[model samples]
Target: MENYLNALLTDVMLKEEEIGDICDKACEILLNEPNMVNVPSPVLICGDIHGQYYDLLTIFKINGTPKSRKYIFLGDYVDRGANGLECFCLLLVYKIMYPSNIFLIRGNHESKDLTKIYGFYDEVAKKYGNSRVWRYCCDVFECLINACLVNGRIFCVHGGLSPSLLDIDEINRIYRLNKLPDNHFVNDLMWSDPDELNPGFSKNSRGAGYTFGSEVTKKFLEINNLTMLVRSHQLAFTGYQMHFKEKCAVTVWSAPNYCYRCGNLASVLRVDENDITGKNFLIFKDTPQKPSSVGLPGYFL
Candidate 1:
């Protein structure tokens, strides 16, 4: 596992068999974790990477590797980028290598249907000449946890609040192991977004999940005894956005120069006990990388 991780970090492409092995091991690790994965404090909370491989590398370059810092990735791991497969594959390797230091949550894109519609399905086929690897990735996605708690106070999820969930603990009742997204709970958690204008839950323009407002966020936080809600599913031009008095909830966007054209900044939220707000946003811009068209048409993200 260490060799695999090192090779990936250095841009050494893993053989198809090696990737399959990594995926198998990753699923094993993820399946054992609860739906609401419990994470420790003083961890970096990363948002959507969207397969900007060079930017993903920049994150580790600025902050040390998993050996030096902990991370909770609020998903959308693959899709809309040239190196989506590489990004996803490397994350799986890291998960297997450092199960205790890294955490990954499900995103709306980690689905077979969405992958097919987005770029992952075709990306895999283009890379491996078959959908075999894509299927393997979907299986691994099935085992990903829905949300995570940091130091028992911060509530973190891929998306925002669900209309059906008044209590955050209700997330554990939703079965997702090897199951298709045939349930609304998973849909809401992975697809939901926050709307600043609305005062209550409203239909999302995304055609799935609810767009919740400040009142909804406050109620959810109070009901769960949580200090803040950290989620990532929408694009934030400045890398991060605060909601409900700038404390109740936040969206952290980590894909810099989204799709290489949106000119948006990306950031990771660092949760520390010593910080005044117990969290800090570490921001960065897109880095230079070899050109490719695999992800150029990713505006749909």
Candidate 2:
């Protein structure tokens, strides 16, 4: 498996069977985890890989290996970029290799509907000439953890909170058996965004989930006895965006130069303790082009 991972690390494509096996193994590890995974501090929190395999590698290169530092990915691993397949596979391999050290939660793009419309579905079909690989990955997506708690002080999710949510236990109670994870409560957890100006919940322009306000974040943290809420579902051209009063929530985007043309920076958050109020942002720009094998098919570009 290490050899295969090493090959993949260098842009070597895996056989279709190898990809299937990876998805299967990732699912096995993910199933045992609760919807709200608990993690220790002194870890790195990343957000919105959105494919961009080369940039993914650059982030890893800068952050060091998962063998030493723990990581929490806020999802959106696929879609909109050139190498969603490779990005997804590499992440699954990491999860399989170090189940406890690396944490992952599902984003809105993990849904079947979104993938079918986005580039991931097409990337799988283009590579394998079938949807089998996509299906395999979708199953693994279903098994991803939905939220994370860092030493009980930081709440990590792919998106903002659902108005109905009062605590992490509520997220765990959600039934985990959906290709889209569109159930009302979970939908907000995966698609909602935080608005610093708004005082409460409002209809999100994204057509799903609400735009949560500072008060909402404040109240949620107060109710949960948490000090910070870390999430990622939007672009922060400077790499990261902070929100809410008391600097309680932050959005960390790891996809530098998003879509290979946004000219935006990216970042990952480093938490050194349970408090998580420490502002440690590791910012970076995009890297060079991907291997021709995983480069855009022109249309996606």
Candidate 3:
């Protein structure tokens, strides 16, 4: 029995190693690929895929391939939507296929605890007969993702600024373990949401965590010296929503038919920063095959 267990463990380790090898080779190819991240490149920033595999595929069809342009996925690649496993697998394949053009970040749903509750764990177990594939794919996710980045002038994260994160690199230092432990700040970073800008803590409507106000966002931005906070969390009927009017923060929601029937349009943001003085955005909207029966909220459109 001991030998058998040892062999099984060794097999898992070897499979993990092979996955890493494929990803590394892909990253190398991306590095050699010419002008992948050059200026004027239209950077495609997508919000929560939530395992909506067909919609994700449709996005690829509309936007062309990630190889042709820069792609930044703001996490939550799994859960709620059917095909969570497929969505994750396809992303891993893409990460290997176009390592240079794609940049993935960690999302709240990516955690094991969240997946277990939100359908991804069950989906994988149902499809694969166990958690092996889910485990494997998640390992790939943590290693391949960058938590947050100070991209020129904007600070990008899966969620928005946490009152705790004073420096951007503090986010980078968040080590990715196979599974998240309870009460960790990084866990909070992944799971927290900023719905309304209140100075005090309010219960998160989504049942995730506390709601943050403009004061937190303001202080966070002021301390970090960031001109804008670009994040993906909370659903927006129009796919992108701006807040504070004065502060340059924006939330880009990409999943359409979100939560199965939120009736929101799928969206993405394309920023052309080549001319620094005159930066502009090209917002892409996905009008689904079936028009949403409900109307968008006032703030979203």
Each prediction's TM-score versus the true structure: 0.93, 0.94, 0.74
Q: For candidate 3, lDDT tens digit of each residue in 109-176?
A: 77767888998888666654567766766555555453434345566677665545577666545545
Ranking of all predicted structures according to TM-score, beginning with the best and ending with the worst:
2, 1, 3
Q: In candidate 2, where is summed lDDT lowest over 10 consecutive residues?
A: 292-301
**Per-residue alpha-carbon lDDT of model 2 for 1-301, expressed as tens digits?**
6966886887666877898899988998999998988898889999999888888888789988677779999999999997888888888888888888898899999978899998889888877778998999989888988999998788998988888787668778866874344447788899999988888999899999989988888888898888888999999999998886578889999999999899999998998875458368999999997554563344533
lDDT of each: 0.83, 0.86, 0.61
How well does model 1 score by local distance difference test?
Answer: 0.83
- State the lDDT of candidate 1 residue by residue for 1-301, as single tens digits: 8888777676665667888898899999988888998777779999999878889999989987777688899999888987888888877777877888889998989888899988888877776678888888988888889999998778888988888888777778767764545446678888888888886999888898889988888887778778888999999999999886656788999999998899999999998853325358998999986665432334422
Residue 120 in candidate 1 has what lDDT?
A: 87
Alpha-carbon shift of residue 74 in model 2 (angstroms): 0.1
Over 4 Å off, model 2: 178-183, 291-301
TM-score of 3: 0.74
Report the C-alpha displacement of residue 257, candidate 1, in angstroms: 0.5
